[model samples]
Target chain A: MTNYHGQWLKLSPVAIIYFAVQFVKDVGNNLIYLLPAILVGYNQFSENGLVIISGLSALLLFVAISALLKFYFYQYRLTDGRVQIHSGVFQKNHIDLPFERIQNVRFEQPIFYRPTNHICMLLDTAGSSKLEAKIIALPKGVAESLKQEILSHKTEQVSNAENEQPEAEHEQILNSRSVQDLIIHGLASNRIWIVLGALAPFFNSLSEKFIAGIENLGVDVDALMASSQYAFWQYVLFFLSIAFIVIAFMALISVLGSVITFYDFKLTRSNDRYIRRNGFFTRHEVVMKLSRLQMIVYQQNWLDRVLQRVNLKFEQLGASLDRQSAGTSGGKIMVPSVTQGEANDLAADAWPENKLSAINYHPVSKRLAVRNTLIAFWLLIPLSGVLAYFGNGELAVASITLFILSTAFIILSWKRWGYAIDDNFIYLRKGLIGVNYRCFPIHKVQQTKLSQSWFMRRFKLCSVKLVLACGGQTLPFIKRTTGEKYIDTCLYQVEALRKSWM
Target chain B: MLADKFSNQSIKPDSLAKVSAQQFTPLSRAYVKVNLMCRLVFWLIVVSVLLVLYWQPWFPLPKMVALYLPQLQLAAGLFGLLSSTYGVIADKNKGYAIRQHDFSYRSGVIFKSVVSQPILRIQHVELKHGPVDRHFGLANLEIYSAGGSMHTFAIPGLPEEKARELRSYVLTHSDIAEND
Candidate 1:
């Protein structure tokens, strides 16, 4: 049994690990500059390595002292239905977060703290730009109890006469990802471009080494370059082999990244919330409540379609900031590499009253296709003219190829643009390469905008934009009458519904 | 091809006509004067800075630039003066309407748009007063929602007292239900 101290208590001594990790990160950041200087002046060091030894010792001493000070100063307490935190060395910052305002309470256990039974706690608030409160290191038992206490307090405050329904009483395992699913997810996601971009700096050295290796093999590379009658079939075979090797390397890196990140992804539903646990080295646990969900997006790219898989993202209120910092797949609850049927099941479970099959999507005005194609042609005229003026036949061919691609893209985008509205929900479908199907509850709209530009006005067309708690979605180039009617219906629904959006 | 599942009988084009027919209360007429004064002051500062830079004896005046410096200054001043004047006149068309459950604001001269936000969705309200606005006895009332790049609504050039009353009314009436 643990001693029951007063409300305000210092974190466990195991918190030193947290501070030490932070200190190492800071040193690593500074080492970018310091390491070069030390290496450049390596000749000045003594034969016994006296200077290096002293410098290393001083860095360790600094990290230890700072970690100790930080651990000593940080203090947190639960009082008056709020989490009160006091910290800072010189400025002494204080934060008071009410239980009702807390959006999520996440518990994370680093690999280093596995034996010590300590974990990190983070609290996210509704509208704040950053975490409302964070406890770097606390005992696992204490963290769990604190989470339960805060959640109970929040339920008590929210369960007024209007919302007296019992929260999620039945917990169920919704879905889990397997290693094969993760591999498929990695193949579907196009992260190879990102890895290739990161390797740009080493490309010159790699090519030089490749050339030297070929020379050592006694290959006449310069003679081949100068030869006009080179065998086309041989060249094609060589290029195909090189492409195969590069693609294989990229596929390996992508699979490794996906495996390490989502080693054991599990999703569970408890009461009114969906909890997702993923990641291997740094575990991520995201909790999203049904009442706080703003929108659901079903996305499938060309590769995803080929694999018969879809990615579903559940966006909750105030998740946009996190999404901006951590891509679309981050912050939000994303179920990746799932079959279309499983995705439909999840969406049906989330919104049982709304039938996804009942959506009747209305395509946008065909004039949008004409407008886009005209713009593409106008852009191509200048590009093709410049290429022809430079007397570059190959570039001229490339420009014509680009023109064809743009035309195809415009047609695809036109075919994809559509919107649907039922009594209780709105569905928007869009995209060219990757189709995005967004469904949102009607009452969750915070604001509605109907806009028309000069060209749109002339064409008797307008656009409607809906701003929800998470983010905004726009349906452009719809008939003016249709846009206006949809806007009015949305406004009416928002005013009629008494249910809470958050 | 698969979009024929749902019915579209509930929505009628006439509903849009009715919504547009609803009258909106115009902003205070004195707002035009306040806007004009602010614009004039901003343009005055910009012109004065340009004049001072040109007047510096140590500053090199290139032969090509010196040839058209006066005309350039005159064109800039005229452009600023005309645009500010037009902006004030355009402010006259701005209007807002407060309904039982929602409020709407209409703005813009060339690309007009009307945005509406339900009262229940309002997260908070604020009254901001700038030094120039204070001198003119005017304030701007800003209403914010849970998440958006811009404020839900920001109505500028309201009387300071009126802005305060509206802020309090919104605060008192916006049912403070638990969110998130």
Candidate 2:
């Protein structure tokens, strides 16, 4: 008797590649164990070569049987309230997952999967590591129907009287972004990473030119530079030209990578979940619950600030789940880059009542500026002494220029740091090059901590950090008395809101 | 995650009073040795720094010591003060309340924060025991609250049986109630 009473299971086009990959991996893994035995047998009985032949035959038989079993036996079914999977040959194996136990379900259709009309579904649960169950190369329509069935089952399970209108089941499939939006956002973020990428080539070219110049010092070309002191400047010009060329090459690579990564990026809304789809080759699909969002952070780099574009990140519950080796995978989920206006619109969509404004605030007074100058002065003290000892006026000037520029940047950043709180939410903004504004409901905060250092305590200054499920929000520096009062008010409101909020 | 708020008579002062003071795992004598060694090492560094600054006659020791003396003294005094205050706060906040709908633990000195979370809101509960805590017959109960930034409401020094009872009660009443 079969558990999942369904027709003969059809393998997804994705299954072909997945099965092939797995087969190769299994063969490779077993080879490590089998290779030594075959080699040893071959050496031991060169005369009686039957041993090696038989051993090879046995290994091939083992690989073939296992691969065939794995590919042929696995079966899945989408029932009314649960997903049933069955596999195994000698001893049958069966597993059923009820919809209620599932935390989230999302589907990804890479370029390859898109052509085949096959989608991979990832089921997340309340476990340390994700991937409780996966149905690879599932039929797209069947997958959607399965998702709807699960959602309907989930809606039926919510016992709350207030939300018992069967309203949760009526999810909206959000509108996708236009190509214009994607191109604009892509261009806005392109320049900075371009400059960063180009820095390596720029430095490499300069170093190479320096080495070349030293190499030419003993050759016929040495006379050109020796006779004409102007040749030193010419050497510098040649190095600068090479640096420019390298910078251009890096800039081109950065632009191309940015375009590919964010090409045709689209964010769609589906009632409780925000669906984000992006990537060129290995397309990614992320589904995030609106209620589960811990905090929404709007960030703008120096270039982005100038461009009036803000990148949005929705920090949600759960640890870093993406197995891909990317740094920005966890902590926050990006909404496929947006302009400041679009970002505000997204925020409004997520939280209709908490409409963010364009108001800005100032941080600390000239003390921040004084601190910046002090850092510069400290660096200059050592630098000027070294320069004076070495009698290098050029080095001294360069050091002074660097010191002044850095100090100015820090002072500007400090001055720009501030926060705004309104209604039942708080917006904390900070940073220089990477400015971010993180907003969340005050009621969501689980813990409000106010810390004071000895210096801060003396000066009546403190730092307030509000801990949320996703992460913590910190007001790094604020007046101690104000900080304490602010924390107390927020805490009282949080408790009161907790009692009344439902 | 805004939890489902419910009112029930399960939460009461009587529930706490029924819990015995004898249930607490008494602080072991090993703490005295560890605490003393830490204090001794700390003071040794302080005394050495002070001596190097003020007592050394070969260099401009007095000036440097004078500059740093207040900061060092303040740091030492504050450490002693905060630790003592923490102990008092811990004592005051020691105890657990099991309400019909939720459980909470309140602690800390300067920041008196209480993690009042509903049993329904708890995604999971973890029971951990350190070697010292185990030796003292104590267990640490960490309750992970969902819908908020993953803040684990932890209570240290709960009797092993009480921890188990609370864990069982929370587990039985949580979202998984239908699973069984």
Candidate 3:
């Protein structure tokens, strides 16, 4: 590994392809706006062949020129204790971050960079999490050396620095995901349904058009449905098969996503820092610092519970969890479909006191269940009353069943609310059917708030909210006195430790 | 489980120095006047704009809509006045305390909250004043910690000089922020 000696250098010319891919990915991510624009522009484009061709070419040329310009302007230099970046063609921006502030130096190898053996380096700062995300198209070996240089430089700063490089640099393979594990992870996650729900309106109109088209073909679909005299058992079997197919389809989509995104998922530890390497098309290698970690989230969905697997997320002290790395290249360290014991060990590595599997959690007050069920009771009246007024007994039964299920969910949610505290870490467990476990150090709490509504005040209940850098966690329906006690304890730890989490 | 070991400690909640909102100092009454004045000016402008829109001949409304324009304007005005009245009442309940170790602000008339940020977490302080606020010698002091924007809360209606003093105090006292 050779030093740059402060010489400013441009990236490999292959970076142009990386930029083009990035441009397409960015556009693909904004499909909501793009879809409508395409719809509105479709009529105009359909009117003329030449106009459509020219418009598409204009878009392509714009992307190409911009990508080329971006690559041309982007320059970087590695010097002692600092990394300088020169980028932004129009804006003419320059950024220099000290080694200590560069929280992570990750090596990313997108699909296009595969042939050339080049990697895109992502430098993450605590506050400006993604603005200075890329220093693209370095040779793979060069990127590795650069990462080591930054990490080692960071170690030489303060003696008690949280990111101090460990003595033995021997790398240890902490965990690896199998194909079966990946499939289980896919089966457990419900993101596909969420996407389907988002696209429901689009699908609704498309479905109506499709049905009209079929009617135009003289298929007599409604008559065909009326003519069929299927037996009750046959109908039940048909519905069960349909349910199985839908579930299988969902699993297929999720499994495909998991395969492409986390094909060879591995979590390895070296010199007190953790590195996650995975993805098929784009070989992603994310380095996570020992210091900046704020929370570990253990997730188990209903399917995951049956399969005895959990999704573990090692969160850092910056971006909120909603914008977490799933489809996007965010700094989310997720190891999905691991055994509970494995998840427990991974969590304990960061926070030694986080014995999540065996922690004795105190359940939230039962009044939560009572209050929620009572609140839900109001919906039952409307659910039945409106349909019953319309003289629909079947609809009434369905609504009644729905109400019962919702009540059960509310009770289960109340039962799931639990929290445990050790000397250093505060572990919170919550869910309905499936469970989620989150734990963070006491000192990581930036602020603690106690809030109460009028009804809660009357019931002597309140919610305690702990604000960490990554996100806020709320403990709802705790006793007012207990909420205050939590606030006191959290503030005491925060002030006493006075440690910088980021 | 370790829950059994803490059974003895459960007899009494650790009598930590109880920091309560009851100890908070009520905001200066001038905040009510300042807020009311701002609201009054706001509603006045809103009414004026509605009147202009109603009487303006360039873009005329349909007969049915025009017939009810005065009523709509009156409703909006009444609503704004009512909200201002509520705001005045809410201002009375707003209190703040700058303690030795932390800063606590108690707010919200209906959904009450007591938020405390440790001094060690204070990242930055901002004191802002608009034209109306300047005229009334008031400033809004916002303190932010090293977290999401939700971790920060704004304290509105501080006297200009007091706001400056508080800003200086926080800047000098936040040793952790300074180190960062």
Candidate 4:
């Protein structure tokens, strides 16, 4: 690719659509206030539709004008060593991101814009600030060529310093999930709960809508309620019906959401980077360098265990603080619904020095179960007494059930909690119903802390927390001696390793 | 699975000499005086405000509270002064150990804890001085990592000159390009 250096270029005209979409999103977010204003205006001037229409048109015009102004101001240029972006309507922001500092480059193309051959390119840097440089709606060819140019420069620099030849650009498909696999993943994941929780706020409005629709059909709700002096069994049946409908709705949404987000999910490795492409309406191409990966987490819920599947997530250096940016593939790479063997193979490919097969995890102290059970018992006893005092037999039964289940979980977690440290990597296994096996190079650890609580001090036990660039993980209820040794060894490795953590 | 061939080595806790054996440098003794002065001023202001509220007619006071307000204020002031004095003494015990490869900070009055971070992992260093600290000619040094709630480590009450020197040393030694 030839260099088009120092040319200040505007985004493709199709970026107008992106800006328009952003405008619509902003309007949607302000709907919480806008809806009430419209309602109040309607109440004030009962049948004045024109007033409401004019107000809405005014709002739309404001959004469109602002979006256009933003599009007019945004410009980017590719210089010799850095990509410079000039944006912000009022603040006049300028950002210069060197190619070497770029941790990952991602390309996204919405299905509607595919015919125009336009793509959104995002560049991430390993910094505390969550600012990402994004170029929206660039011609697909231009985006691809520019990405290649920057990446080639980065690879050239790395290879020149290391005095080694760059690897051939041969893409290898590590794993691809089938429709069946997606369905299993959807079932195994907790998306249904999340969707249900999100919908909780709108439940009252949904029910109101339903009742209004019934009333519009001329049903006498009051009379029906008065007539139905339901028996115990009939009430149970009615409640069960509502629950079944809600569960079925949530399940459908969860399945559709997962399928849409992860359709044609494919993981491929090219040189020292792993590229993932997925999603249906909006295609995402995420690139993750092997060196930038901080940890590999193998997670398995009870459903996943039953299905003999695991979800592997590769966390990178920095966390995406903004919830909006989380939608884009930046901070972490997830491979959903893969077999254990495939997960191991991928981990090995990513970090060959760490022998996952040879890991011998030492379990945490057994007394952890006793301590946890005692704490649970103490808390649950009072909770159960309160429920009994309230004369709520159903809630009392539920609380007892929860107490028993938690006791079992505590025991199971105590049995599963373990850690293993080899010369190169540290592996930590923890969970109850869902087990997570997290492993990272010892050298990547930023900090280590050995803490002893009053209870742990009594038992001559301590917990060790390993802080990474992304976050910290704890191995609890270990003998103080072992915890200190692990911390010391990890510290030594972190200091001795010459390679950068990122 | 090679779980059977794993050799588990157990070392005595006391035998681990890395952080324990390293001598730590305590904060400037004047820091205690600074803390004491700040605490006293803060408590004095709080007590004065409370006394004004009790005596002033702007706010309606309950009859019972008005009856014993002066006594209550006296007891509260005494308690505040004593606790602040104790707190200053306790903070004096806080110390930091800077090793060749890492730095450890030990703090706490009742439950002591030692947190160590590899020098290579430090993202940035900051020296901050508040009004009270400026009055005392002291500054606080904060070290942060790439991600977390707040600073990975903070050492309060260092002489301003020493703080600046340490900050420069950290900035010079930290290799940002290696991480990039």
Please state the CAPRI-style docking class of candidate 4: acceptable
List candidate 2 stretches off by more than 4 Å: A1-10, A19-80, A84-96, A159-184, A190-241, A319-333, A359-406, A499-502, B1-125, B137-180
Predicted candidate 4 versus true structure: per-residue lDDT over A1-502, tens digit per residue: 3456789988877787788787787668778556646544656766777987898799878878877888999999888878899987998888899987887799988886799988999987765344568888788888888898889888898789888888778899999999888888887887778656766876787778788889899996776566767666886787899999987777777778789989999999988889999998999999988888999999999889999999999988655354225454444789998998998898888998876656889999988899898888888877888989999878888888888999998999998898998777999898888889989998888888777777788888988888887678788889987887888877766665545686
**The best candidate in terms of DockQ:** 3
Clashing pairs in 3: none
Q: What is the C-alpha RMSD of each candidate to the true structure, in Å?
A: 5.3, 11.1, 4.6, 4.9
Return the top candidate by lDDT. 3
lDDT of 1 by residue, A50-107 (tens): 7689988998998899889888999987776777889877778898888888888876
Query: DockQ for all models, in order?
Result: 0.38, 0.10, 0.44, 0.34
| 2 or 3, greater by TM-score | 3
User: Which segments of candidate 3 are over 4 A away from where they belong?
Assistant: A1-3, A30-32, A36-65, A160-166, A212-219, A228-243, A321-329, A378-405, B1-13, B44-78
The per-residue C-alpha lDDT of model 2 at residue B97 equals 55
Candidate 1 runs further than 4 Å off? A1-5, A26-60, A158-170, A195-224, A227-233, A322-331, A377-404, B1-19, B40-55, B67-71, B149-151, B174-180
Worst 10 residues of 3 chain A by lDDT: A320-329
Better of 1 and 4 by TM-score: 4
TM-score: model 2, chain A? 0.72
For residues A364-472, what per-residue lDDT tens digits would candidate 2 score against the true structure?
5455466567868997868877996899988888888888788878787786678777656787877877687878877676555555544444566666777666666
Give every prediction's interface RMSD.
Answer: 5.4, 9.3, 5.0, 5.8
Candidate 2 chain A: worst 10 consecutive residues by lDDT? A322-331
